[model samples]
Target: MRSQQFLIFLLILKVNLKDVLLGFGNLKPGLKYSVLIFAVALPVMAYGSTLSDFSQYYPIWKPASDSTWNFILYESAIAIRMLATEFFYRGFLMWTLMEKMDERYANLIHSFVYMLMHIGKPPLEVPYSFIGGYVFAWVDLRSKSILPSFLIHFLGSLVFDLMIINQVFICL
Candidate 1:
């Protein structure tokens, strides 16, 4: 049987993917903003990753083997989760709460929830996620697509993972 992580990833993948495709696809519009937000956030996340002891808390799945398939499967799951997370925060939330109420409130609510998700994480990251989440939500609000937000979330997370691993391996 697939592990619990894979199962959760599957569920998220199905729901979030459907929402993005059905709700507000046509990703062309958000592509430019995605690149811009990602580029803008990359360096900051990189710097923050270095400052925080992220390696201690992340990459939950360790290498089972050095085989290519092992890395592919692991990273692919990570990528899926990143996409799913952003879709929920930036896409689903935007459609639901933002549609019902003003977008500013929706963004704040999303950011607060996003921040809460980081509670067990490093102290710095907890607050950072809220602020960063707001920025991404705002970007989505402006761009009218979650594409840019997804790109930023995924790339930012991947970069942090890389930084954490790099710091560990370099020191050893």
Candidate 2:
């Protein structure tokens, strides 16, 4: 599953793997921007977690239950999935679109598609996904790589899972 999009991007699109994944030029700015955006997002995510019962929807941590090893495995898998997702959205889609059109339109297209993917998730999340998607695309464009957005997505998801766990197991 992870290799499919990458293969398409490489073979079909003829995009260089490094250009899409590692990007060209300096990456420090993207890294810093990712950190700053996440810092701001933490509080918003925290509050959003309170607005909905995420456990009913995701239940991602439920399968692991009480096993520490299982939890680690789940998180690892999620991180890998996020990597693939970023590659597809930020790397494949955006880069391909940018080749034919303006960067803004390409990014907006990417953001819309990105948001659509979150439709079945939490209600609040569906709407904000557009905003988050746009920001992530912007960060990827600025950094010229998907690494920064990948980190943000993976870490934010991990934190949200923890918050849901707290609400499900600890608070209740």
Indicate which candidate wins on lDDT: 2
What are the models' TM-scores? 0.71, 0.87
Candidate 1: lDDT of 87?
68
lDDT computed for candidate 2? 0.80
Candidate 1 per-residue lDDT, tens place, 20-101, comes to 3323555665677677767777777777767646656666676712444664676788877777777667766665676578
The collision pairs in model 2 are none
lDDT of 1 at 96: 69
Candidate 1 regions with alpha-carbon error over 4 angstroms: 1-29, 64-69, 167-172
Please, what are the lDDT tens digits per residue for candidate 2 over residues 24-143? 545899889988999999999888767655656654656754655666788898998888888888887887888899989998998999999988787888778898889988988887
Cα lDDT computed for each candidate against the true fold: 0.68, 0.80
Candidate No. with top TM-score: 2
Residue 65 lDDT in model 2? 45
